[model samples]
Target chain A: AQTVTQSQPEMSVQEAETVTLSCTYDTSENNYYLFWYKQPPSRQMILVIRQEAYKQQNATENRFSVNFQKAAKSFSLKISDSQLGDTAMYFCAFVTSNTDKLIFGTGTRLQVFP
Target chain B: SAVISQKPSRDICQRGTSLTIQCQVDSQVTMMFWYRQQPGQSLTLIATANQGSEATYESGFVIDKFPISRPNLTFSTLTVSNMSPEDSSIYLCSVEVRGAAGNTIYFGEGSWLTVV
Candidate 1:
């Protein structure tokens, strides 16, 4: 069984600033994928960024990036130049190569204050 | 990227009733998944729907409670049978699409069911 943990229940960031949301997971599988999903007020789940466990380099998507430390079992999401639209509930997810089922964290409620 | 749509975006049902949610995809897919998101919580996989076969359920889920149907590649349906307050959660339909690195899962808007 695999589990994802998001220690921070809530977080706040000032507009135009940067914010980092922490995430950790426990999985025995070597080949896996990590993802960060954003659910806005509209209740639409949007993919923020994803990182492959085999990749040493972090994944960056415009303003969203991930700091993936495979040895530490840590995958954190960083939002740079944050805007009000970034305010949402962020969830960290894990999926193994064998089974495509996703395991998600509790989520971090992020508020981008102007 | 494929577009997934779920019907009856939301509904209020009485206990002991059943609600069947429909999911349609723009492209053909091999696997379709159903998930449940409780209020203020993360998503949990309910079952995996595959065309031409019975659905595979997760540990805590059973076919009697959540009956799923996948008659083809681009469509599936999930029915919440004998609903209760505990079943009042957001039901989402998802499909995996191949991405640059690997497969990425995309979710529908979700069907919000409120049982009283």
Candidate 2:
């Protein structure tokens, strides 16, 4: 079985600043995918970014980026220039190649303050 | 990215009554899934909606309690039977689209059900 662990329960960052959310997963399979999703009060699940296991280069989407370490099984999300709109619940997810089922972490509530 | 839509965005239902939520995708997809998210919690997989077949539910969920139907490749419905206060949560419909990046999962707006 695969499991995703998010150490941070809550996080806060000032507007225009940066915050990094930590995520780690345990999986024996070599081929898998990691993802970060944001859910605001609207109850919508928005995909922030994703990283493929085979890709050595980290994934970046504008202000959002991931630091993926395959050997350590660590995938951290860094949001630069955080804005008030970034205030939401962020979840880290892992999925293997064999199945499309996504294993999600407990989630970290992020609050961006002015 | 596939555009997913869910009906009954939010509803208040009575206990013991059943509510069915519909999901529609803009394009054909091979995989569709249903998820449940409690207040202030992460999303949990409820079942996998396969086209032209029965849905495969996850642990702690049953077919009688949460029956799902996927009539075609682009549509599915999930019915919650005998609702309770504990069933007051957000039900999300998701689909997987394989791209160069990988198999990415996209979700619908979600249906918020409050059982009173």
Candidate 3:
């Protein structure tokens, strides 16, 4: 069974600053995928970014990037030039190549202050 | 990205009752998924709804408890049978969309269920 762990329960960053959310997972499969999702007060889950295990280059989407260390099973999300709209509960997810299911981490609440 | 909508955005139901939530997508999709998010907890996948096939449920979930229907490529429904207080949570429906990274998933606003 694969399990995702988000160490930080909460995080806050000032506008235009940077913040990083830590996530780790336990899995035996070499081929898999990792994702970061944002859920605002509206309760809509939106994908922030995704990283494939086979790719050595980390995934970056505008102000969001991930530090994916496959050997250590660590995938951290870094948000730069944070804006107030970025304030939300961020979740890290893991998906294996074999199944359509995705295992999610506990989640971290991010507050971007103006 | 696919725009998804869920019906009965929220409802308060008595224990032992059943609630059916509908999920409609703006465009045809390959798959739909039902998930549960308990208070202050991570999202837990309940089942995968595939058109023309019986929904595949995850461990700890069963067809009897959470019956699903995917009549077409753009719509699906999930029913929580014999609901209890423990079942109080937000039920979300999602669709897998094509993206640069292969398949990307998007979710609806979710139907909040409170069983008392």
For all candidates in order, the CA lDDT equals 0.93, 0.95, 0.92
Question: Whose lDDT is higher: candidate 2's or candidate 3's?
Answer: 2
Which order, best to worst by DockQ? 2, 3, 1
lDDT of 3 by residue, B1-116 (tens): 78899998999999999999999999998878999999988899999998999999988999999999999999999999999999999999987776667667788989999999
Cα lDDT of model 3 by residue, A20-77, tens digit: 9999999999888899999999888889999989899999999999999999999999
Candidate number of the best TM-score: 2
Tens digits of per-residue lDDT for model 1, A19-64: 9999999999999989999999778788888888989999999999
Model 2: residues with Cα > 4 Å off, grouped in runs: none
Tell how far residue B28 is off in model 2, in angstroms.
Answer: 0.2
Can you tell me which runs of candidate 1 are displaced by over 4 Å? none
Per-candidate TM-scores read 0.97, 0.98, 0.93
Interface RMSD of each: 0.9, 0.7, 1.1
DockQ of candidate 3, scored on C-alphas against the true complex (2 decimals): 0.75
**Which 10-residue span in candidate 1 chain A carries the lowest summed lDDT?**
A41-50
Query: Individual DockQ of the candidates?
Result: 0.74, 0.90, 0.75
Off by over 4 Å in 3: B98-100
* lDDT tens per residue, model 2, A27-81: 9999998999999989899999999999999999999999999999999999999
Ranking by lDDT: 2, 1, 3
What residue pairs are clashing in model 3?
Answer: none
Better of 1 and 3 by lDDT: 1
Please count the clashing residue pairs in each candidate, in the order shown: 0, 0, 0
